[model samples]
Target: MVSGTSRAAGNLSAEVTNLVGRRGESAEVRRLLAASRLVTLTGPGGVGKTRLAIDVARRLQSSFHDGAWLTALAQLTEPDLLVPTLMSAIDNGAYESVRVEELTALIGDRQMLLVLDNCEHLLDACAALTAEVLRSCPYIRVLTTSLEPLQIDGESLYRVPPLSVTLSGRTFGAAVAGSDAVKLFMQRARAFNPDFSTTEDEERAIVDLCRRLDGLPLAIELAAAATRAMPVKVLAERARDALTLRSAGSRTAPSRHQTLRATMDYTYQLCSGKAGKLWACMSVFRSGVDIVGLEQVCVGDDLPLEDLWSTLAELVDKSIVNLNGSRYVMLEVIRRYGQERLTELGEEDVVRSKLRSYVEDIVDELHSGWFGPGQQAVLARVLTERASVRDVLSDYLRKSADLRSGLRVAANLWPLWISSGNPAEGRHWLDALLTASTEPTQERAAALWVDARLTLMEGDLTGALRLLDECESVASALGDLVSLARATTCRGGAYLYAGRVEDAMPFLKRGVKLERNLQDDNPHRAVGMGELAFALILRGDLEGAEQVLNEAKAFCARHGEQLLLSWVLVYQGLVALLDERVGDCVALVVDALDRKRAVDDPLGITYAIEILGWASFARGDARRAAALLSANEVRAERPGTHLMRDMPMVEWHASYVGQVRERLGARAFEAAWERGRRLTGADLFDYALAAKVPAVHDAPDLPLTPREREIAELVAVGKTNKEIASTLVIAHRTVDTHVENILTKLDFKSRTQIAALFGARARPET
Candidate 1:
């Protein structure tokens, strides 16, 4: 029944390249289409929205009796020919004489999916035709690929996100290989040179290229094509220039898509004057910018300050700019294109200078906000604009100008580097600024302390000690009490982490006394107190540790310091564990885990998981303990600097493993441990929290229809027929029929038996 004009049975084009990633998005799109008559895939141009829409329609070909029809609207120069073009695409013949009403009647009541591609240029025409078709044919569904929504009644819009290049902390190797962006690049690379292989460096270079391209499929493909003539490193280095090169795309693609610049030019030409000007000016921001920033830098000349928001709205509607919540971002390729336009208009220098000033102001605000109640919000903002800040620092330092500004910005971001698990990137910026500036100012002293903290996180105790010595010397020369306190605290933390507890205590106490004497509500005093307690605990001074922790906890609560509060909870949990109060330890550590998860602190979460695992082992839940340890191991192995290497983790790990092995025996413990390791972090948390394993039965020996199998699997998950119907976007009667057929095929009398059988079969054998 599925028939249309194409090599495939449907009107979908024969895909020359494989669709990579987007498995979740594809399923969600299918579900949306099943429930709504009109579903529009909307994103910026060249984001692969058209290809995704076609792929979704092709998958649902069997569901539509007549077929999925594709009408490409990109080539239509006038709105008058819209209906005629669609009719020809669907009918496989000339429909020059057919009127729009007659064409709507021709599609009447036929169950089908009509795909309207590239509808941004023909919005009015596409919307008019779509309204007519949907009103006349109730059973017909329309799927659209557009830069903007058709905005008709009952339309579902899904914004297509770019391919993921990073997961958790992984960015290269096997992890990078799994990303859809990298997969697309490799596939296209092999297409040109079949014998092509990559070394580790080349693979990393490709990953960097994909990331720089912002995972745009068209850009990735073009970059991949260049690999035929150039090495990956060379291609990555020249990517900004390569976007202007043409004729790399498939001949079958539209002329607009044959080159990156052409694709952008098409979109750019469609934008109105104000929108286009705004886009050009906004390009100066290398990362996302808020409305305030846009107003400050992107207003003047052709783009009046009063027209900013409205023009931005139009640009967003046209998909020329992406507005994510309060911040706006453009795809890297689009930004580059806009930058080129700005240069053409001779405003690049003005825009860039404005951008630099705005960023400098932001960094100053962040520095002032670092120790206040708004610290978390400031940190989040810095994380969002980290790339822009890095670029500005590099430019300032490279030119040997604004050295003090660069030094202050680097120094101010110490808490972020230490807590956000991005110490390596932070260290890179800090090193550049420190090496570029020779003056021993307060800014340099603070930057040196930040550098020492980051170095300590990387397990370089010797290097950290050296950095701290320099920091102390600079702080003494500058007579900066705050920098001196921070330096001394970091020194103590480094010694403690290196297992020199007695040596750590003196520095820790000295830092705490200095901070308290300054009469400041600084969080470093809290940090110093917590570290001193840990050193005391490791030295068997339990009473001293408890008193110090109590003081630290009260300080953290008064200051609204969640990160510091979480560490305090960890120390309390350790004290409870030392006291053999397993239940108390578990309760405290779980609360700590919640705090860490709220702040997205992975290192804190890892440490809490270690403590929870120990408490579980003490409570005789060996399997749960093993699972928690495995989860910690997985988290610790993420691509970043290590943060958990203290005495408690080391002692607890060895003891927990030894005790669990003795209790469960080597073979059974290994099996359980491996099972835990395979579970993702969220899955592991669920496993640890679940009361008991569900019962299961073996798989039935009868073959079943795909629909029946699908229904059976849903039934096994304990969903009723009505729930399954809603989830699958089908009629309740259809689910009942499928379930009936499933039971009949398996000779089961009850859904309970079906659930048990499917559950056992679906779960992997342990």
Candidate 2:
């Protein structure tokens, strides 16, 4: 199933909007992908390269073991960060930076398609990276879209043509309704303005507009957006005037690029002053932004906050901006035009500064909260604007702005950086800021501990200790108790991860003591107390551990926090297990696992499952313990095996596995573990949480008799009656009779239907 490779699976996301028209092009792309490892869909801007590539990949994703994944490079301005960005996108938000070697190895010989969108801005980097991947990964097919090709060896270039438009002596025809361009125009036009009637006259006007725009999808879309306010004929008649007004464009660029720019120019002219200004301001964002982000960054003296919504809606109506779910965005090319407008207005620096301030305020708010009920919502809100925020920070750091301010922003984003933002990127930002600003300020002290926490999460014990050392030194000198507490606890966490219980005990207690009495409702404070409890358990102090966890749980309950609350329960379960309260241990861990699942924390859920296994072993249910411990999760087959193996919680896991092995003979234990691997989805959850044995059932029999079934299989494989007769060593007449009976039994109209039913793509006539 991996095409030609050994392993991995594709992970293409579902499209938010329907693809208008690209039937012929999609088939051609599939054919190209079948033969070529690297296919570049090259065309002028606005020809729908990105959309077509994604559509074709979606159709073909299942054929590759590792499915097609798209990496949108429009936001990445730094070439050095390209590899990490690629890794993040392809890995679907893996929280670490992967080396080029590691990336290729992880994808080694796996069949997948990598769709690189908008490579025009970073052609050299895209080319180099593409070359390296194709060299190291023989089975991965690369489909890239750009204004031009990546220009590498063995590259197959598919010059994507504009959607077809029927022409009759430079005039409209009745057949024009069937044209791809006309269909696209009608669809976009009707979508924006439901009241706009699509009569035969309207179709004629749409056909004329499509033909005049040279059948370019983007130009057609822009023209169609104006149909709500005026007739399609009006927009069609005005098209030539708009196209010629902006006759100036890059000579090297294609004519379609000029046409698109001219359309943008006309779209801009149609806007009121306030609308135009806000549109330009909105360009400062690297990607989409929510309403709050738009108001904070775009609205000011020239554009009042109250009037911002109307102006944004105006642009959206004109098709210059698109409202995608909660965020407003301009297409990459549209964003570029807006950026030009921003620069022309001489407000680029001021606008970028506003974005930086907005990001700073957001991160500060996130830092102040994020351990309570609103935690997930706040994190998601900021993440929605991550691209814009990251661009602002990158712009600030590049301009050599206040290094300490940047460091503070990075420090405040610990939740994002460590838990969500791919801590590797956070480390990179912090490392850059830290190297630039060596002064032992309170900001730097805070950044040091946050970076240490990230390193601790990464299991980099020595690196964490080194950062914590600097953090302690700076905080001690500055007399910042909060920073000191963070650093001390983070250091203890590192030692605890390494199982250095005695080495961790003193620092854990001091850290908890320093943070426990803080008046503010900080989430980190409760988590710190919970860490001390974990250290106490590892140190053989059950009562002390229980007392600490009870306090941690109460603190979290007061804050309405479930994540840290779940951890408190896990710790309590450990204490109960050590106290020989087997029922309490199972109840506590199962309850914790339920909470962990609610928060979507894979590691936490795995920890709860492991603790539950310990309870099973204590009860002398060796068979139940083996079943509980089996790799039975359907890859969820062994629900937490991979994470469990690499986690620092391996301290007790190996010892327990040895105990279970000693109790059940190795062979019988292996059989139970294999059974565990067979469990998936709801069944796995049911058995894991309640010890309900999974039920087994057999599939229903097929309707066809043996010989008729054989004939049906042949038809599904695209064999004709002649081939079926030859293969089955039967008379041609008999094969035909069998085929007819098979069709009647399935109530099918065509052989293609049978092929589809069997999950085989019906091969087309040559």
Candidate 3:
């Protein structure tokens, strides 16, 4: 038998709709209650534990003569109120002055099931009161829901798993109809749209949507409610965006569970002090974050580093955060909820700025380490945080009129954009920033040069040359030697790509000469030197090309410039091929291909493969040459601006295509080329190198400790030593020591140089 009388019989509200899943879980809870005095339903937030507990209590109410009663503990903030709240729920006539002993005696012989919802916040109070009630009454069974077990004696814990969505050996329609996740989705979806029907395609999309949402009941329901206006396919495509969806649930439901954000907001309200601050600050990370990253980015403004781990643990106990091995993660809905709270507290801008600064530091370190044995590690780290980096750059570019940091960050990540096959995204950010920035500062000048490079990669030679002219004009007006050198080099490369080798020589020569005198070992110098070598080889100046190539190689070796080194090797390989050292050419280009692969540099690898194909053709291996050329062409079709702008390589590839076609006949060569085109980037490298790539490991020689780096970053952003000391809670002398250590470690002579390196200017005191 079942009953639903709302507050009259118990605190359990009448179900507006039947609970759609958890039949097995409900039965197990019933069985556990028969033998145990206390049965707790424990799981993460939004996993249906509360709903399942309510369902179980409703089903077994007839067996208890005093009836099943519920005392919702989520609303009670103080632990001291636990006994009074329970006494009121059991009987309104009970006096407010009744203590725990009096309440226990008052409930002495009642045969009832007490449903305690959300006991995680008041664990000690709840545990003490529960133990006293069970000992005194003996007939009252307690059913509680919490994120963690009470760990009291005689407590039976039943963890509620999410609804099952895994379907096998069934058609799409059959799977949707059978799945508990899909059934709940369809039920809620129909509430908003009665005429809704799951067609074959929509069924498949819904199944994937449920799986992507982790089959959490509330998330599925929230997504289904969105189907009132959008198709299932559209909902699936925008699931990540659905985290922001609000208030589409039944009004009768608990205010917390009525919306996804409210559900998380309830959990957030349970956290106090440092827990709340940590929760808000962690929203800056888009994915899993380790303790080291949290310490680096979240250690300021009332959240000291000493309290971070304990606060994180507190949040984990409340189920607001999850622990995945060494890393911590928040569910998407929870992250959005915290983000909303962060905005409410007016810390959104501060956190966003800190996040941007952290990413900038990461990019700077990666740039410095690009040519070392740890190149692969650097690539992996950047790829891991690529989404967050993109979000930071996009936010700064689109929302801010002051394009200082946005432009510089975009310019600094040029190699990343090329290596990660995201030049199109890079170009989008650069273009937006340039449009917003009216001042012709050196930052804008540098942005224009990067913009032109991406433009040239997309086969837009004229547009690229026009942007370069603009860059050169800005640089000349400001007399920014660094910007001028970059612009000149990019302009010369653009002309070369347009098949004007002679027209490119003067710019290349001038840029190389200017870079040679610069004090810093900038990567642009390696770029200029490499391009000059390529142009010399195109003009039949072999000795000049060899000397330039050697210079570029030495410079890259000093600066750890792996990408530029690969370019130099390509030119050397071409020179060797022309001198009839086919074996040496093959060996050099193959080694260059390996180096490019180490850095995961797609553009450099493409150029190397094309050169290797040309070398193979020179050795009379048309089949091998055709296959390699086809692989390069496949990469060119990816969703980005191509960075292979070398005119000599381009012209050679065009000529080789015809030679391979005539030599192997169209049909056979086309067949082999198609085979190569189907290979993925990793698979192509495996085939070319004939070796399995090892997993990237951690790199030693991190320049500073996480805390020291955090302090240095604060210093770079123009914080005075005293201000830094106050923010991080260190002494003024400690800040001075850290700053002095930073200068010594980075080989900088003054704080001004550190500021210049990180693109920060000191602010005047008020």
lDDT of 1 by residue, 1-766 (tens): 2344343345776776678888898999998987888999988877899888878987887677777899888888888888888888887888665678878887887778899999999898889889989999888899998888888999999999888887343544668667888889899889989998999888888888888888988888888888888889998888777566555647788998888898989988888888888889988777778988898788877788888888998888877788778889888889899989999989876887777777777777776666657777888887888777777777777667688878887777777777788788889989988998979899899899989988887778988999999999988987899889999989999999888888898999999888787755677888899889989888888889999999999888887778888888988988888889776777787778777766777677778777777776776566666766776777777634263565556666877878877877787688768866886655554443321222222223347877787888899889999999999999999999999887676555567557644653454334
lDDT of 2 by residue, 6-71 (tens): 333556667765887788899998999888899988765577888899998888787787788888
Q: Which stretches of candidate 3 lie over 4 Å from their true place?
A: 1-44, 50-117, 126-145, 148-184, 187-195, 199-215, 226-252, 288-293, 324-327, 364-383, 394-401, 617-621, 640-647, 691-766
Report lDDT (Cα) of residue 562, candidate 2.
82
- N/CA/C clash count, model 1: 0
Q: Residue 76 of candidate 3: its Cα lDDT?
A: 83
Candidate 3, residues 1-766, lDDT tens digits: the string is 1235333355567887889978899999999998788999987778988889889988887777677898888778888778888888888655455689888887888778899999988888898889888888877889999977787899998878778998855576665678999899999889888999887888889888888777888889889888887888999998876555554747656777776766776677668878888888898788867787788777886888888878888877777787888778876667766787789889888887778777888777676665555666776777777777887887886676547888887887777776676678778889988888868899899899999988887778888888898998999999999888888888888887777889999999999888877856677788888878878888899899999899888877876667778878877988898888877776777788877776666677777777777765675556556777888888766655262455566667788899988888877788758866876656566444421111011112437677766776686677899999999998999889988987777655565435423321122111
The parts of candidate 2 lying over 4 Å away from their true place are 1-263, 616-648, 661-687, 690-766
lDDT of each: 0.80, 0.73, 0.77
RMSD of each: 10.9, 24.5, 17.4
Model 1 misplacement above 4 A: 1-242, 248-258, 270-273, 300-302, 360-375, 620-644, 647-652, 659-676, 686-766
For model 1, state the Cα shift of residue 652 in Å.
5.4
List TM-score per model, in order: 0.68, 0.57, 0.71
- Please give the ranking of all candidate structures by lDDT, highest first, separated by commas: 1, 3, 2
Indicate whether candidate 2 or candidate 3 has the larger lDDT: 3
